[model samples]
Target: MPKAQETVLEINLKALKHNFEYLKSKLNTNTKFLAVVKAFAYGSDACEIAKYLQKLDVDYLAVAYVNEGVALRNAGITKPILVLHPQAVNFKLLIERCLEPSLYNAKILNEFIAVAQQEKQTSYPIHIKFNTGLNRLGFCEKDIDYITSKIAETSSIKISSIFSHLAASEDLNEKEFTLKQIESFKTISKNMIESLGYKPLLHICNTSGILNYPEAHLDMVRSGIGLYGFGNSEKENKNLKPVATLKSIISQIHHIEKGETVGYNRAFKSDGFLKTATLPIGHADGIGRQYGNGNGFVTINNKKALIIGNVCMDMIMVNITNIDCKEGDEVIIFGEKPSASIFAQTVNTISYEVITGVSQRIKRKLV
Candidate 1:
């Protein structure tokens, strides 16, 4: 509706469906899929993706926080959503919306249980997160008993799933370590479930694990990046389709003589005659400052254009010297060619950050 102009993140729902089917194909018949829709569905539009996923009847959806879950609920998403890092402060809101929370530690488990008891909640679903070497969130191995005690004391909360974060499921060099993590998680989860005398969903695989270690996938798989196309391995990425494609129209083109500088700080000094095309996107739109001074490049008419100088808050200049381009020419930042993974590597990061880092300012159009 905003006119097929300026900067736009073209979202392919068909590709999303395809990726989901591909991942689903790799799992057991009874294995569930929890689509991670946090960070505005990886900065592509959570509301839209959630709606589409709900229509597809995905087993579940996951968000990083309680507020994100509430947003999806507000958007009329009724599918079960797991809040991966729910804080104690949001326990009430989480319970109010019938949203499930991941009880990672004693503090969270007890706090949520107390809230549930106060709200007269019974058999409420809650996930237990174990720290399987990620060292980020989740309860550590020593805290297992603490969680068990809390669950035994509280009859109000029901354990929904026991999950963990993998440290490096994507790296082939870390296969042994990855296996150790999987075994540790499996052993811990089994012990806890048996001790509790109840059955709960078991899941530990993220996008990478779903591809690299299907054996680690027990009952469910929480996929984020895989749903958006880019995989940890080139082989895994083959069947997947990239969901988010960034495109911008060149607003203006300028001829730069030798010695002329471009952009802020004169970071890029033009060498010989050059043509610079200005795109209507920048850091504010998720192209960080790191992608400057020829470090990151984009494609125009299938030709590579080196990003010239520092990326501004609202604009970026590309050296389109040999290309015949003019105002309104389409420029691809990351899509189809080069790929988001290539761009992420250029910034010394991963495609996950690249896609999730895209700011909300850019319009997201679902195709």
Candidate 2:
């Protein structure tokens, strides 16, 4: 790739393919793959990513809301899209778009049944979420009878899959907890399958779960961060390639003498003669204010330039006195060498937050 002349996020589909294949290698030959393309494909272009994944023959796609699923449908994505969280108000629109909803509770289940009945639909696909341990969403174990009774009352909707979310599949210390969650899900799925007299697809593993728990791969696996080139651990990260590279160019160079201040609120006072390079990216572009005051650094001409002072809305100044660089020179915020995970670790955050927090206003150059 050429040096960036302006602030741009380079989305490498080749890298995405590599990550996809790598993750697929870990699954059984018969296991299905569900690509989670929510939050704009983790702050990349969701439509483009979904299109590419469709070509790769992904078994299913998932989004967090009805509108997100609708966006994919508008983008010509015809794959089975699972709406991880759908509201009562959008049930009609969801059905119209052929998007499956994850009915987690009695209220949601009843509401969706009403909508499906009103729509005169038959056997519309729906996923049931069980609260094994996440405690965020899904039905309780005791609710299985209620859920089955409700299902028996209606043929308008059918259970397409039963799933759950693992709270900490990445941490080895949480092995016991994760195992319990998996076992609970197995029990729930068993009873539900027996009650329904048929088997719906069973899946509960996320990216970390896919990497850490191969035994729980069940019938399908959902991967979000892994598909975006992160495995949530040092060992697995080595096998994946980052899909997004944030790049920018030096807009201006400032020569600061002793006692000269830089940026808002005079955040930095130079103690000696030095140089600073201002790049056209800041909080507005997802660099965030927490990365300022020497906390964050960018790569310039193969050198590390520490971000000085506070991050402005649209620009950040990095000390480049020791680096051999000039205006219009390429700058790397985070990619390859210093991955997004490494960049985020400087401020005690995670790669998901940093990548997904990237502002949509920034140009995304697909490669």
Per-candidate local distance difference test: 0.89, 0.96
Error of 1 at 319 (Å): 0.8
Per-residue lDDT value at 45 in model 1: 92
Clash pairs (backbone) in predicted model 2: none
Report the C-alpha lDDT of model 1 over 1-367, residue by residue, as the tens digit: 2334779999989999999899899999999999999999987999999999999999999998999999999999999999988889999999999899988777677788889999999889999988888888888777777778877887798888999989999998999999999999988987887788987999999999998998888999999989989788888878789898898989999999999999888888877998999999999988999999888999988899988899999999998988987799788888657679988888699888888988888888888
Name the best candidate (by lDDT).
Answer: 2
Q: What lDDT does candidate 2 reach at residue 191?
A: 96
Cα lDDT tens digits for candidate 2, 1-367? 7889899999999999999999999999999999999999998999999999999999999999999999999999999999999999999999999999999999999999999999999999999999988889999999999999999999898999999999999999999999999999999999999999999999999999999999999999999999999999999999999999999999999999999999999999999999999999999999999999999999998899999999999999999999998899999998787899999999999999999999999999998
Worst 10 residues of 1 by lDDT: 1-10
Global fold similarity of model 1 (TM-score): 0.96
Question: TM per model?
Answer: 0.96, 0.99
- Runs in model 1 lying further than 4 Å from the true structure: 1-4
